[model samples]
Target: MRPDEILIIDRDTVERCLAKQDPVALVESMLHHHAAGGTVLPAEGYLAWRNGVGAYTRAIAMLGGSDTSSGRTYGMKLINASVSNPGLGIERAGGFTVLFDPETARPTALVEAGFISAERTAAYTMSTLRVLGPAGFDEVSIVGCGTIARAHVRLLHRYFGAVRRIHVHDIDPERARRFASDVTGRFPEYTVDIHPDVHSCVSASQVLVTLTVSDEPYIEAGSLRPGTFVAHVSLDDLRPEVFEHAQAVYVDDLGLVCDNPRRILGALIRDGRVAVPGTSDAPGSGPGRAITGAYGDVLRGALPAVRPDDGFVVSNPFGMAVADVVMGRAVADLARAEGLGVMVDLLGAATRAGGAA
Candidate 1:
């Protein structure tokens, strides 16, 4: 294969090739590897433009680390999120990932990332549950009914085998009903019900996952039951006070959180209202001290959740670049092995040969 040639894997091919547990396992290994001091993740680049109500675009770019366990590979994922896409009967988020050969610094493959993002997000949630979730739980609640929420439901059903009930809530009642119907048709073993409100949906379940796009905090403080594991997938759905009241808070990366201050927890910490985990004199002090550990630490068992009066254990993953890149690399490798995707001269002919651009 030529160094400048790129493998192009589209969304349909990725959906077809992804097995039931591929993303979950890949995300688990990457998190463990990252915490083991084998990965390098720089601060993510972010750009957002606001047009008007229900109109905006957010572009994100970040490079993930080399996968030493899988032959020194690395990648970068670029995502463009348009809030109005769904109104046009399209996916709200779309992006592409570029896998690289670390040794040569040559781009290896370009893969569609919208589906990959959902899969990785779901995988990350399940991975966190494996370490932080209460054992032998019966019910789980999800607060949003979108593509990512659907992925989460599928993963939670697969991982939380003992949970018999799934309560879902969405601002759009029709969407919620549709989500419930789809879930019921797919997984008949579990009972899928739609709740009219977030409080009822959250308070009733042992595990609560929030994926809403609410700009303001709708997850009221003191509403969640003690011992509830809340996975806040949407970065800003919960109030800072919610974190202040939680027993413990875990994020995907401290740097990512600290950098994106607009994120609920990030804002609290960045404004000095909440201190970073290791910097505090007393753990869980004030509103700013809630963030005590990262998800990687949880996976390493370095940070254990200590229940305090049945308060919530909040796990916040701000969607890492490494997760997307690693998963994309794995899917790209699979496509290569099975003779999938189109090989195109993305960089044109090699510059060394003086091929005119």
Candidate 2:
């Protein structure tokens, strides 16, 4: 590729490239970089509007830069999420990432980000699971059967090794059954059961992951067994009372949790139901109160492990923008190495023709 040209990688290429990448390692490294404080990550930019069909649509622009082994890499992702796009028979999420030449501020490549988002999101959960999950879980339950659920199912198995049983439940039974069948076919050694109801699916499992889009909570506070590790992959699936059941609660970003539009945890805290670790209100609170901190603290050894007797461990992660940029850099490098995208001088040609006017 020419120095002034930019590579354009489509979604299929990104999917193919990511399949060969180790998501865990990539995200782990990204988190470490994030925690180590060298990366430049600005607050994400977001906008919401109504589409032609009156369906809600959202767009996100996340930007970040960090020094890599090769050099400093910067990237920004533009993501559009059409909440009701299922009516149109296409995936609801789509986006593209632009990696830049740090010194020249020239575009390096534009790669699709839908798969990257899914993989990195799952990777973030896996990283937290490694730090906060119980020593071992015999049976795990997944409460959603969508894109995030599939990523979680595959990564949990790949990273944690085999489990005895994986119970899956979805509002749509057909989706649950289909997910169960597909996972069963792929991993015959583990039992993949499809549950018709949420309570039964979550009640006895040692680990439970909720990945639904429910605006209201469905998982009761007392549904999970003691010592269960819960990954709140989606924000609204669990009720506020669920915090009272957590022995420890970890979040990716405390600020985001306390202020985002879907500030479920923040609402609970304001109601005096949830107690953060360092807060004055936390002390003297009764059992089932949460001791909250960032997962990075756990990784950095600033926070101790959740004891086996800690009752229930929960983590709610509001993903970081640094992750998307880091992943984009990796994809850009891979595309360059494999010669996998189209090259074009997006603005250089026009600028050169325009001269100094």
**Top candidate (lDDT):** 1
lDDT of 1 by residue, 1-357 (tens): 577788888898888777633678888788878877778898778899975674878998888884644666688999888878767778778889999877788888889998899999998888777777776577888998889988887777767778778898898898888888898899888798888988899888778889887778878767888777888999688877788777788888788787877777777776676677768533344545547777777677787754334677788888878888888877877777777777777656332212322
Candidate 2 C-alpha lDDT tens digits along 1-357? 446777777778777777778887777776556567767877889999999989889999988887666677798889888868755767677888888888778787888888788788889888877777878766789998877787777787788775768988988788788788888888787798888889999885878888877778778777878878888888688777677767778886666666665656766765566766666664333342655787766776777767334477788887776677787777777876776766667566422211212
How close to the true structure is residue 221 of candidate 1, measured as C-alpha lDDT? 68
What TM-score do all the candidates reach, one by one? 0.90, 0.87
* Clash pairs detected, candidate 2: none
lDDT of 2: 0.76
Looking at candidate 1, the ten consecutive residues that score lowest on lDDT are 348-357
Which regions of candidate 2 deviate over 4 angstroms?
A: 1-4, 270-272, 275-277, 282-291, 307-310, 347-357
Clashing residue pairs in all predictions, respectively, total 4, 0
